[model samples]
Target chain A: MKFSISRSQFIKTLNDVQRAIASKATIPILTGLKIAVSETGVTLTGSDADISIEATITQSDEKAQLLIEEPGNIVLPARFFGEIVKRLPEDQMTLTVGEGFQTTITSGTSSFNLNGLDANGYPHLPEIDAENKLTLPADILKQIISQTVIAVSNQESRPILTGVHILVKDNQLLAVATDSHRLSQRKLEINNGQGLEYDVIIPGKSLTELSKIITDDLEEVDLRITENQVLFTAGPIKFYSRLLEGNYPDTDRLIPHDATTTIEFNTQKLLASVERASLLSHASQNNVVRLVLDPEAKEGTIYSNSPELGNVQESLAFENLTGEKLDISFNPDYMKDALRSFGPTDIKVAFTSALRPFTLVPSEDEENFIQLITPVRTF
Target chain B: MKFSISRSQFIKTLNDVQRAIASKATIPILTGLKIAVSETGVTLTGSDADISIEATITQSDEKAQLLIEEPGNIVLPARFFGEIVKRLPEDQMTLTVGEGFQTTITSGTSSFNLNGLDANGYPHLPEIDAENKLTLPADILKQIISQTVIAVSNQESRPILTGVHILVKDNQLLAVATDSHRLSQRKLEINNGQGLEYDVIIPGKSLTELSKIITDDLEEVDLRITENQVLFTAGPIKFYSRLLEGNYPDTDRLIPHDATTTIEFNTQKLLASVERASLLSHASQNNVVRLVLDPEAKEGTIYSNSPELGNVQESLAFENLTGEKLDISFNPDYMKDALRSFGPTDIKVAFTSALRPFTLVPSEDEENFIQLITPVRTF
Candidate 1:
C-alpha cells in the first residue's frame, strides 16, 4: 500500500480506530490495525472481537490530502504506528508497503520502517441486516449513553446485566441500566415509523467507545440492528458491536410506585454536602451516609460516622420538605453519580421508607430521566 | 488547637506539611500532623522517619488570616484534616478542640468532628546545630536539585547513591548524583567566605518534596547543615531532612578528561529526533539507539532497529562536526535525560571512543554543568 496523507487527518482517524484495539487480545493479530489502500481511497480497521471500528478516507476528500499511488493492504501494530505518526516531523506523511509486508513511513528527514503482518489473517467484519434502520442525532445518543452507562453491572456473574438495554418503539427510544444497587434510565423522542420496533442489549463497554467516536458536534448517526450484531455509521466511520444473547431482566417492577416522602433542593448544593459527608463514610466499610429530615424544624441533615476516623454532618435547606419525619441511609457514591448526570437545576428526591429504594428526577418535565438507588440498612 | 483560619491559608499550610506524613508509618503518631495553637498564631508539623516539615501561620502576618481563640496542641490525621480544610463551604473555618482531644471543625453549615491523638505522643523534631549556615536563593537551589536529582540511584543496594552528594566549598556549591550508568553534576556560585566548607548527602525523595515547597516567588532559604541532619527554613516554613551516613563514591574519576570527537547541535532538534527513534527502541528490551557522525558530510544520524518491530533512522545537519568519524550506541532514555538537563541551546556532545563513556556540556561558559552516560556495547 502506497499512499500520502495529511498528518492531521490521518491522526484523527488513527485515534478513532485505535480505541477498539485491545491491549491484550486472545488472537495476537487482533492487536494490530489493518490498513488497506485502493485506487480510490484508504481504509483503516481495528477490532477486539466484541467491537470493531473502521474509518475510511476517499480520494474525493481533498481535505484529507490523500493520494494513492498503489493498491495494497497490510496490518501494523496499532500502538507503535500511532506513536510514530504522532511524532512525525512534518505535516505530510507518505506510507509505502513493500514486499514481505515491510511498511515504511517517511516525512521530512525522518523515516520509520515498521514490520507489518499479513492483512489476510485479520477476521472480516460480520454482515448485519439493514432492514431495521434508524437515524438519530449524535448529540442525543451520546447523552443517553452517558446517563445510563455508568450504572451497568461491573460483575461478570450476571452477563446480561453488564449491558444497557435499549428499546426503540413507534417514535420513542428508551435506554435503561441497573446494577441491582442503582439504576439509571433515560428516554428520548425518535423519528421512526410505527411498523418497526427494535430491542437490543449493547455491552456498556462498547457504548463507552461508541460515545467517544460520536462527538457532540456530529449531526447524525445511522444505526442498523440485526439478530446478533448492530452497526453504527457516523460520517465515514463504521462502528460494529456484538449483541448480548441472553434476555435482559424486567426492571420496570423494581422502580417504586408511590413516594412516602419528597424533598426538593438545589442539585449542586445537595451534591456538595453529600460529597463532604462521604469523606468519612468512604473510609467506613459500608460506605453509607444517613439523610435525616425534620418536618417541624423545616431542615435536613446529611450525617456520616466512622468509629475509627470520626464523623461529618452537613445541613442543606430544602424548598419543600413534607411527609412524616424520615431518616434514610444509602451509598453516597450512587447519589453523587445520579446528581452529576442531571443539569444544574433543582431535583426532587422521593423515598418510600428508610429501608426501600429511592428515586431522583429533575424538577423540569422536559427531560425524561430518573435515577434509583437502593437504601442500605444502617440500624 | 482552636483557630478560625482562612480556608485558603489553611489549605496551603496543610499541603506543605502533609508531604512529610507517610501513608503507612512504623509509629502510629507519625501519620498525624501536630497542630499547636498559641495566642499569637498556629503551627502545623508533619513528619515521617526521614523528613519533617513545619509550617507556621502567625497572627501578625496579614496574609494568613488566623485568629487564635485558645492555646493548645493536638495531633490530627494529616490526610483527613487536609481534605476537610480543602472542601470547607466558607472562606473561614473554625477548629475547636474539647476535652479528650475531640476536635470539631465548623464552617457555614458543615461540621467535621475528628478524633485527635495527644500531642505528647508525636515524635519531636531532632535538634540540629546551626554552627554552619548559608543563605541561598530558593530558585537556584531548586535548579541545582532538578539538574542532578534525576540521576540518583533508585536501587537500595547502594544507600549512599540514593541521595545527591552536595559539596559547598569556599564560594561554590556542587551537587552530583549517579547510578553507575549515568552521572550528572552541576555547580553554582554561592556568596560564602573562605572560612568553612559544608558537605552532605540529602535523600532524593526528600529533595523532591522540598522542591514542591520552594515556589518561584520565594526569595531565600536559610540552609543549616549539622552532623546528622540538614535544616532549610523558607519564610515561616521549616523543613528538616535526615542525611545519609555512608561516604559517597569518587565520581570525579568517571568524567572523561579529553574528547576525540566533539559535535554541536541544537538541543531541541536532537531531542525531538531521538524521541522519535525511542518509539521503537523503547519497545525493545535494551532501549538502545545508535549515533553515527560523519565529519566529511558534517551531519549526524540516529538509528534504532528491532528485529520484530523494524528500524528507524533520522538524519540531522550538525552545527560543527570535527575529528574522526565515530559511531556509538547507548540507552536513549539516559541520553534524553542528559539532554533535558541542559538549557535550550546548542549542546556539545563529546565522545572518546566507542567503548569509553561520553559527556554532554552546555556550549556556553556561564553555567557549570556536565552529564556523562556510559555507552552500551552493541558488538
Candidate 2:
C-alpha cells in the first residue's frame, strides 16, 4: 500500500486508534496496529483482545489530503510507528508497503523502514447489528460514563462489579456502577428509544476510553450491543468492547430511602474540606474521616487524625442542615470523587445513622442522579 | 511562632526550602522545616545534611503581608506543611506555635493542628567566608549550571564525578563535568577577579535545585566559599551546599586539538535527527546510532537499527563538510544531551578518527563552550 497524507490529520486518527493497542499483548500481532488502504479511504485498527478501536480516513476529507497510489494492508508496531510519524520532518508523509511486508515511511529527506506483520493474521472484529443501535448525545453519554465509572471496582475478585450495569426500558436509560462499598447511578431520558429494551454490563474502563474519544467536535455517539460485544461509534471512529459475562448485582435496593440527617453544601467547598481532612487520614492506617452534625446547635465539623502525623479539624461549610444530629466515619477519597462528579453544583448529603449508607444527590435534580457511600463501622 | 501571612507568598518560599528536604532523611529533624519568626521577618529553613536552603520573608514585602504577632521558632514537617499551606481555604493564613511544640495553622474555617519539633534541634547551616564573595548574573550562572550538570555521573561508584568541577582564576570562571563517556565544559568571563583564585566541586543535584529556585525575578546571585561549603545567596534565598572533598581529574588534556574531518549543522536540525535515530537505537540492546560522513560525496547520513524491530536512515542536513570520510557509532542519548545544552545555534563537529572522541562547539564562538563524546567501536 502506498499513500501520502497530511501528517497532523493522520496523527489525530492514529492517536484515537492507538489507545486500544496494549504495550505487551499475549498475542504479539495484537500489539501492532493494522492499516488498510483502499480507493475510497484508509482504515486503522488497534486491539487488545478485550477492546478494539478503528478509525477511518477518507479521500473526501479535506483536512486529511489523502492521496492513495495503491490499495493494500500492513500491521506496523503501534508505538514505534506513532513516534516516527510524530517526529517526521514535514507537513505531509508518504507510507508504502514493499516486498515481504517491509513498510517504508518517508517525510522530507527522512525515511523509516519497518518490518510489518501481515494484516490478514489480525483477529476479525465482531459483527455488530446496525438495526439495534441506540444513539445518544455525546455530552450526556460522556457525563454518564464519568460519573458511574469512578464507582466501578478496580479489583478482579468480583469480575461483574468491574463493569457498569446499563439498562434501557420505557424510554429511560439508566447506568449504575458499584464496588460493594459505594455506588453511583445516573439516569438519562431517551427520546428515540424506539420501543426497544436492552440490558448489558459494560466494563467501566471501556466507557472511560469511549468518553475520552467523544470529543467536543463529536455531536452524537451510536451504541450497538451484540451477545458478547458492544460497539460505540463516534464520527469515523468505531470503538468495540467485550461485554462482561454474568449478572450484575441489584444495586437498586442498596440505596437508602430514609435519612436521620441531611445537609446541603456547595460541592467545591465540601471537596476542599474532605481533601484537607484526607491528608491526615491518608497518613493514618484506617484512612477514615469523621463528620459531626448537630441539629440543635446548627453546627458541622469534619475531623481526621494520624497517630504519627497529628490531627486536623475544620468547621464544615453548609448551605442548609436539618433533621436529627449524626456522626459518621467513612473513606474521604470516595466522598471527594462523588463531590467532584457533581461539578460545581450544590449537593444535599443524607445520612442514616453512623454505620448505614449515605446518599449524595444534586439539590435541583435529586431523582435523576445519586451517589451512595457506605459508612465505616469505626466504633 | 505566631504569624499571619499571604498564603501565596509563604508558599513560594516554602517550595524553595522544601527542595532541600528529603523524604527519608537520616536525621529526623532535617526532614522538618524550621520556621524562625522575628519582629522583622520570618525565615524558613530546610536541610538534608548535605544541602540546606533558607528563604526569608520580610514584613516590609507587600506581597507577603506578613504580620508577626510574636517572636519564636518551631520546626514543622516540610512536605506536610507545604501541602497544607497549598490547600488552605483563604488567601491569608495564621500559623501559631503553642505549648509542647503543637502548631495550629488556620485559614478561613479550616484548621490543621500538626505536631511540631523544637527548632533548636535543627542542624545549623554552614558558615561561609562572607568577605570573599563573587557575584555573577543569575541568568549566566543558571546557564552554566544547566550546561555542565547534564554530564555529571549519576552513579555513586565515584562520588566526585557526581559534581561539576568549578575553577575561578584570571578573570575567568570555568565549569566542567563528565561521566567518562561524554564531557561538557563551559566557561564564563568574570570582570572582577580581585586577584583571588579558588577551585571547588559542587554536587550536580545541589546545583540543579539551586538553578530551579533562581527564577527570572532574581537579578544576581552572590557566591561565598568556605573551607568545605559553597553558599549561593540569591536575594533573600541562601542556598548552602557542602563541597565534594576530592581533587577533580584534569580534563584539559582529554580534548583533542586536531581533527581529520569536520561538519557544521544547525543545532536544532541535528538534534531532531539524533532524536529520531535514538528511537530505534533505544529498542536495541546496545543503544547506538551510526553517523557516516563522506567529504568526497558531500553526504552525511545517520542510521540505527534493532534486531527485532528494524532500521531507520536519514540524509543529514549540514551547512559544510570537509577533510576526510568517516563512519562513527555512539550512544544517541549522550549525543542528545550534548546537543540540547547548545540551545539553538549552528555547531561545528570535529572528529579525529572513527574510534576517537569528537567535539561539538558553537560555530560563532568555539573557545568558551565545548561538548565531547567518545565514539563506540562498532565492529
In model 1, the Cα lDDT at residue A32 comes to 98
Question: Per-residue lDDT of B1-379 in model 2, one digit per residue for the tens?
Answer: 7999999999989999999999888888888999999989999999988899999999999999999999999999888888899999999999999999999999999989999999888888887756878889999999999999999999999999999999999989999999999999999899876965889999999999999999999999999888799999999999999999999999999999999999999989999999999999999999999999999999999999988888999999997799999999999999999999999999999999999999999999999999999999889
Clashing pairs in 1: none
Cα error of candidate 2 at position A313, Å = 1.2
Q: Could you give candidate 1's per-residue lDDT for residues A1-379 as a string of tens digits? A: 7999999999999999999998789999999999988889899999999999999999898889898899999999998899999999999999999989999999999999989999999999988867767888888888889999989999999999999999888688889999999999898887664456888999999999999999766999988989899899999899999999888889889888788888898888888898899999988888999999887789899999999989998888688888878999999999998888886899998888999898998888525899999999977
**What are the per-residue Cα lDDT tens digits for candidate 2 across A65-142?**
999999999999999999999998998999999999999999998989999999999999988866877899999999
Q: For each prediction, how big is the interface RMSD?
A: 0.7, 1.0
Model 1 docking tier (incorrect/acceptable/medium/high): high
Error of 2 at A145 (Å): 0.2
> Candidate 1 — which residues are off by over 4 angstroms?
none
Considering chain A alone, what is the TM-score of candidate 2? 0.99
DockQ of each: 0.84, 0.80
